[model samples]
Target: MTYKGNSIFKGKFFVWLALIILAVVPLFSGLYWQGILVLVCYYAYAAIAWNFICGYAGTMSLGHSVYMGIGGYISTIILETKGVSPWIGMIVGAAVAMCLGVIISYPTFRLKGPYFTLSSIAIVELLGTFISNTESLGPVPIKGGSGWSLSQTGNQAVMFEFSSKLSYFYIAFALMVIGLFVTYRMSESKLGYYLVAIRSDDDAAKSLGINVTKYKLIAMAISCFMISIAGTFYAQYFRYIGPDRIFSYDLSVQVALIALIGGQGTVMGPIIGAIILVPLSEMLSAKFAGQMSGLNLFLYGVVMMLVVYFMPHGFGEHVVSILQKAEEKIFGRIKRKAKD
Candidate 1:
C-alpha cells in the first residue's frame, strides 16, 4: 500500500484498539481508579473543545468555563424541576451554550489576541458576579450573612446521581468518544482548512474570500456545544453543581493547559495532553493535597512551564515524529537485508 493508505489504516486500527481497551477497563480497575479515569475522560473532552478555538482558530479564551458552568446548571435545573431526563437535558444545555458562544463571539472576534482573551476573562467575571448576587437564581439563599440550599433535592438517578463510580466512568468514556469523533471530523473538513487559514493569517484568509467571522463563529459554536455536553455529563456524574466549582477561571486554564501540553491543533494532541496531565495531577492531589494544600497545583504549574519551554509542540507531535523515524530506519534495514 501507499504511505497515505498505510497511515489511514494505522489510524483506524489504533482507534479500534483504543475503543476495545476502554470497553474492558472498567471490568478490571477498582472503584477509585475508575473514578479517576472518569475525571480523565471529562478533562479530555474539555481539552478537545478548547483546542478547537485556541489551537485551531488561534483564539485564546480565558473564560471557556462559562459555557461548561452554564451547561451544567441548565441541565441540572431542567432535569430536577421539569422532570426531564438528563439525556434530553444534554441537548438543551448544549443549545444554550451554542447561543451564548454566538453572542460572545460577535463582539469579541473583532479583537486581536490578548485583547480577545481579556474580554473573555471580563465576561466570565461579570457573569460570575451576576450569578452569585442574583437572589432568585443564586446557588444559596442568603439570610443576612448566612446562606441556604440552592439545589433541588430528589432521587439521585433522576437528577443524574449514581451510587456506583462505574456508571460515571462509562458516561464519561462515551462523552470522550463523541468529543474525539467530532474533533476528528472537523479537522478533516473544509471548515477545518478555513480555520487553519484564519489562524495563520486572518487578513490573508479574508483576502482569499474566506468568511472569517462566519467560520470563527461556527468554530466557537461547535466548541461550546461539545464542551456543554461535557458539562451535562459532569452534573450527572457529580450530582451537584455550584458556580465556584464550575465557572471558575481555573477550569478554563486547565483546559488550555491540557491542549497546549498535548500538541494543540493536531487531532490527537488534546487527548494526549489530557491523558498525561490529568492523571499526574490527580495522583499528586490525592497523595499530597490534604497535607500540603496548594503544593500539587504549584508542581503542576512548574511542570507546565517546563513543557512549554522544551516541548512547545506537545508530546503527541513528538511521539508521532519518533514513530515515523523508527519506521524509516526499520524499512531501510529491511531493504539492505533484501539486497544481502
Candidate 2:
C-alpha cells in the first residue's frame, strides 16, 4: 500500500485505467457476462462504502446489510405504493440511513474490536426481524416475510428501470466510480487524518484534542448515506428484495469480506477484490450448486482463511508493489531510449 512513485501516476493513473477498461468491457460483453459484471460492480460499491467506517475509521461492522435493507425497502415501498421513483427513495433512504447510523454509532462507538462488530450484528438482526415479521411499519407495507417487489415502470430512465442489463451495469459501475472518488477525497481531508489517528489509538487521539466520537460519527454518517444509495441501485436492478436477502448477515459479510480481501482502506482494494471474488463465486455456483449446495461457500471460506494467513493486508499491497516496479521499469526504459 506504500509504493511511492510519481505523484500523478501513483495518485490517479491506475485508478482511471481500471475504470476505463471496465467502461469498455460491456461493449463486448454478452447478456450473461454483463449480469456477472453488474454484480461485481454492485459488491465493489458496497465494499467501498463499507470501507469508510470499518476500513479507515477502524470500526468493524458486520451488519451493514441493515443499511442496505432499509434503503431497498424505502425505495421499493415508495415506488410500489406512491408510484414514485426509486431515485427519490435513494435520497430519502440516505437521510434516514444517516440518522440511523448516528444512532447506532453514538452508543456503540465506545465498544471496540470484536465487541463493536457483535453489537452491530445484534442490531441488524433486531431490525431485520421487526421488518420481516411485521406486516406494516406505520403506513408502508412490509408485506411480512414474503418481501416486496419493485413496480415495473416499463423501461423508464427516470424510474431507474431499464430493459437491458447494460444500463444496470453502467449504473453500478458509475456508483463504484463515485464511491472511489469520495473515498479518495475523504482520505485527503482533515476528517480522514483524525480517523487515522483514532484508528491507531483513540486515547492518544483524544489526548491530542481530537473529538474521537464526533469524527467516527461523521464517518458512519457518510458510510450509511453512501451505502443506502447503493441499496436503491440494487433494488432497481434486481426488481425484488426481501429481509432474508437484503437484511441477511451473509450480505454484510460479503461486503466486509470483499473490502478486507481487497486490502481495506486502500483506494482500489475493494475493486480488485470484487474482480477476483465475484466471478469465482459465480463459477463455483454454476459448476457445483447442483451436486453440493454449500460447496461454494465452503471453498470461499477456505480462500478467506488462506488470505488471512498469507496476505493479511489483502491483495492490494502486493498489487501496488508490482505495479510500482512495472512503472519504474517502463519509464526507466523510456528515459534510457530518449538519452540514446
Candidate 3:
C-alpha cells in the first residue's frame, strides 16, 4: 500500500482500539472512576460542541451556558409539569436552543472578536437574571434560590434516571461518541472548509461570495443543539438544575478552555482535552478537599499557562504530530528491511 493508505489504516486501528478501551472501562473500574469517566465524557461532549463554532467558525461565544441552562430548565419543567418523559423533553430542549441560536446570531454575529465575546458574556448574565426573576415559566423558578429537581421516577431508561454510575457512564459515552462523530463529519465536509475560510478571513470569504452570516448561524445552531442535548443528560444524571449552577459563565469558559487545550479545529481535540483535564481536576479536588481551598483551581491555571506557552496550537495537535512521526519511522524501517 502507499504511505498515505498505510497511515490511514494505522489511524483507524488506533481509533478503534481507543473506543474499545473506553467501552470496557466500567467493567474493571470502581464507582469513583466510573463517575469521573462520566464527567469526562460530559465535559468533552460540551467542549466538542463549543468547538464547532469557536474552533472552526471562529466565533468566540462566552454564553454557551445559556443553552445548557435552557436545556436543563426546559426538560426538567416538562417532566415535572407535563408528565412527559425526559427523552421527549430532550428533543424539545434542543429545538428551543436552536431557535435561541438563531436569535443570538443575528445580533452577535455582526460583532467580531472580543466584541462578540463580550456580547456572549452579556447574554449569559441576562439569561441568568431573567431565569432567576421569572417564576411564571415553571412551578419552580429555574433561577430561584431553590432551583429545580427531578424525582427518581419509575423506569430507568424511560425516566432518564439511572441508579448506577455505570449506566450514566454508558449514556455519557454514547453522547460523547455522537459528538465525536459529528465533529469528524463536520471537519471533513465542505461546510467545514467554508467555516475555516470564514474564520481565517471573513472579508476575503465574503469577497469570494461566501454568505458569512448564514454559515455562522448554521454553525451556531448546530453547536447550541449539541450542547443542549448534553444539558439534558446532565440534568438527568445529577437530578437537579439551577440557573446559578448550569448557566454560570465559568461553565462556558471551561468548555472553551477544553477545546483550546485539546487542539481546536481537530476532531480529537476536545476529547483529548477532557480525558486529560477532567481526571486531573477530579483527582486534585479529591486529594485537596478542604485542605487547600483554592489549590486545585490554582493548579489548573498554572497547567493552562504551561500548555499555552509550550503547545500553543493545543496538546492534541502536538501529540498527533509525534505519533505520525513515530509511525513513519517504523514503517520506513519495515520498507527498508523488505527492500534488503
Candidate 4:
C-alpha cells in the first residue's frame, strides 16, 4: 500500500512537471502560438470553474456563460468608458457574478438533473436577450453591427491594452496557476468530501447532517467568481466584448466539455481537458474556417461523443487508474519476492 501511494505521488509529480514546462512555452513560441496558448489558459480557468459545480457539486449548469458574459461586459465597460483599472474591474465583475450565482442558487437548489440543466440554459438565453435589447447602457454594441466600433486608445493601466501577446499570455498563465492551486486545495478539504457526498446522492448526503443547500451555494459562488476572472481575462486580451461572443451558448458548452473530458470531480481534469482540446480545436478551426464552415464544430461533437462512450470518467481519472494499477503490480511482485 505504501509503495502504491508513492507511485501515485510520483505520477502526480510528473504531471505537475509537464504543466510547468507547458506554462513557459510562451517565452519561446511565436506571437500567433502565444495567442493560442493564452486562450488555452483562459479556457482552462473557465473549465476549472465549471468543474467546481458540475463535477464536484453534481449540479450541471448550461448557463455559466451568463456569468462570464456579464463579467466581461461589466468589466470592459468600466475599464473602457469609466476609465477604471482592469484589475479593479475584475473584482467588480467577480462580485457581480457571485451575486448572480446566489440569486440563481436560491430557487434552483431544489432542482436536480435535467430540470436544473434546462433552467440554466433558459437563464443564459434570458440574460443574452436582455443585454441585446437594453442599449441604454452606453451602446453595448454587438460585433459587426452598424454602430459597432472596435477602436480604443487610452491609458495603459485603465484600459488593460498591451502591444504584445506575451503580456496577456503571462497574465492568463498566472490565473490558471491560481485556479489549479485553489482546486487542489478544495479537492482535499472537508468541503470536497461534502461535495462528493452531495453529488453521489443528495438525499443520502442530506441525511448525513450535511447542509446541502449551503454547500451547493458555496460551490456556485466560488465557481462563478472563478469564471468571472476568466471573463476579465477575455475582455482584456481580445479588447472587445459583446453578448454573442462572450455569453454565447458555445462558450458555455466548451467549459462543460473541457471539464467532462478531462475528468469531472478531479482537481486537474479541467486543465487536462483544456490543454488537449483547445489546441486541437484551434488547429481545426484555422484550417477549415473559410473552406468548410461548421466542420470543426462537427468534429468537436464527434470527439465528445467518443470520449463519453469510451471514457465516461474522463482522461485524468483514466490516467490515475492506470498509474495505480501499475504501482500495485510492481509492489505485489516486490512483496512476493521478500516473502520468498
The most accurate candidate by TM-score is 2
Q: Clashing residue pairs, candidate 3? A: none
Q: Which candidate is the best by lDDT?
A: 2
- List, residue by residue over 7-92, the lDDT tens digit for candidate 2: 22464766787789998988798987898999999999999999988888788899998998888888888888888888898999
Score each candidate by Cα lDDT. 0.77, 0.85, 0.83, 0.79
**How well does each candidate superpose onto the true structure, as a TM-score?**
0.87, 0.95, 0.92, 0.88
Model 1, span 242-326: residue lDDT tens? 6776777878888888887877787777777777787787888898857977765676578679888988767776665665576
What residue pairs clash in candidate 2, if any at all?
none
lDDT of 4 by residue, 1-340 (tens): 1222113354675567767887778888898799789888899899989998888988889889998877777777776677778788899999999998999878987888989998998888887777766765556433321112335664364457777888777788888888877877777778888998999999999999999999999989999999998888787777767777667778798789888888788777888788888888888889877887777567667778989999877877666666668766878689788999
Query: Relative to the unseen true structure, what is the C-alpha lDDT of residue 153 in candidate 3, on a scale of 0 to 100?
Result: 65
Candidate 3 — which residues are off by over 4 angstroms? Answer: 1-10, 138-143, 325-340
Better of 2 and 4 by lDDT: 2
lDDT of 2: 0.85
Report residue 306 deviation for candidate 3 (angstroms).
2.0
* lDDT per residue as tens, model 3, 1-340: 2121113244665556667898898889999999899999999999999998898888888889999888878898889878788889999999999899889788889998999999999999988888777777545534465678778764477888777888889888999889888877777677888898998899999999999999889989999999999889889999888877788898898888888788777777788888888899889889988888777566657767888898877777666666667777888799788999
Better of 2 and 3 by TM-score: 2
The predicted structure with the larger lDDT, 3 or 4, is 3
Per-candidate RMSD vs. true structure?
A: 4.3, 2.0, 3.2, 4.2
